[model samples]
Target: TKSQKIRAELLFKQFEDIKHVYYYSLELGKIFSTNYDKDVARAKLALWYNKIEEYGYDTFTTVANSIENHYERILNFFVNRSTNAAAEAFNAKIKAFRASFRGVVDMRFFLFRLAKVYA
Candidate 1:
């Protein structure tokens, strides 16, 4: 395992793009994985944006632009580190339940059954 890691590091050093991309990914993971304050998170994200631009990779440029576009919404994560995961999961469950029943026929009954089971 140690040898494998050394070989991987050598390869990363040999490839400029790979090294940049790998470090960028690692930095982004560190940014989100830590429970940093909002200001600290924002500062890190700003640094990340600049770093991505400096990398000058087309794909990363596009991703950076997207982040810029949704900047506020993304930053809101630092407030509570919450996401719409629960809502999305519930929606998926509803879809699966409907599919299992071969689709909804009576809207009223469907609402009642959904409320009884999931409410």
Candidate 2:
């Protein structure tokens, strides 16, 4: 939508800081989307970290600190872009079942039902 792009450009012009944040987010998306080799992606991620640090934005800085803390596990994505989406979905399903039950009165029955559904 060229019109939407034009409108966004106009709006972005009015807010320089917002524009920077927006573009930086878009750049981060690009870094993930690009099918770069692991080495290149790692380097890009490091560079992105440094760039965000330079901005000194508290929100991005907090995210940077978290990323730094779990950097190794995070970087494992470069291996094959693997994710815990399936595990998350399973957890969600379990939560939904729990919510539906309100509370499990019979522990054995609940375990059997959970095994039937999930195992």
lDDT for every model? 0.91, 0.87
Q: TM-score: which candidate is best?
A: 2
lDDT of 1 by residue, 42-107 (tens): 999999999998878998899899989998898899999999999999999999888989989898
Task: Report the C-alpha lDDT of model 2 over 28-91, residue by residue, as the tens digit.
Answer: 8898788777789879889999999999888788878997898878777878988888999999
How far is 37's C-alpha from truth in model 1 (Å)?
A: 1.7
Worst lDDT run of 10 residues, candidate 1, spans 16-25
TM-score of 2: 0.85
What TM-score, over all chains together, does every model reach?
0.82, 0.85
Q: What is the C-alpha RMSD of each candidate to the true structure, in Å?
A: 2.1, 1.9
- TM-score, model 1 to reference: 0.82
**Which clashing pairs does model 2 show?**
none
Q: Report lDDT (Cα) of residue 98, candidate 1.
A: 87
Give the residue spans of candidate 2 off by over 4 A. Answer: none
- Candidate 1: deviation at residue 50, Å? 1.4
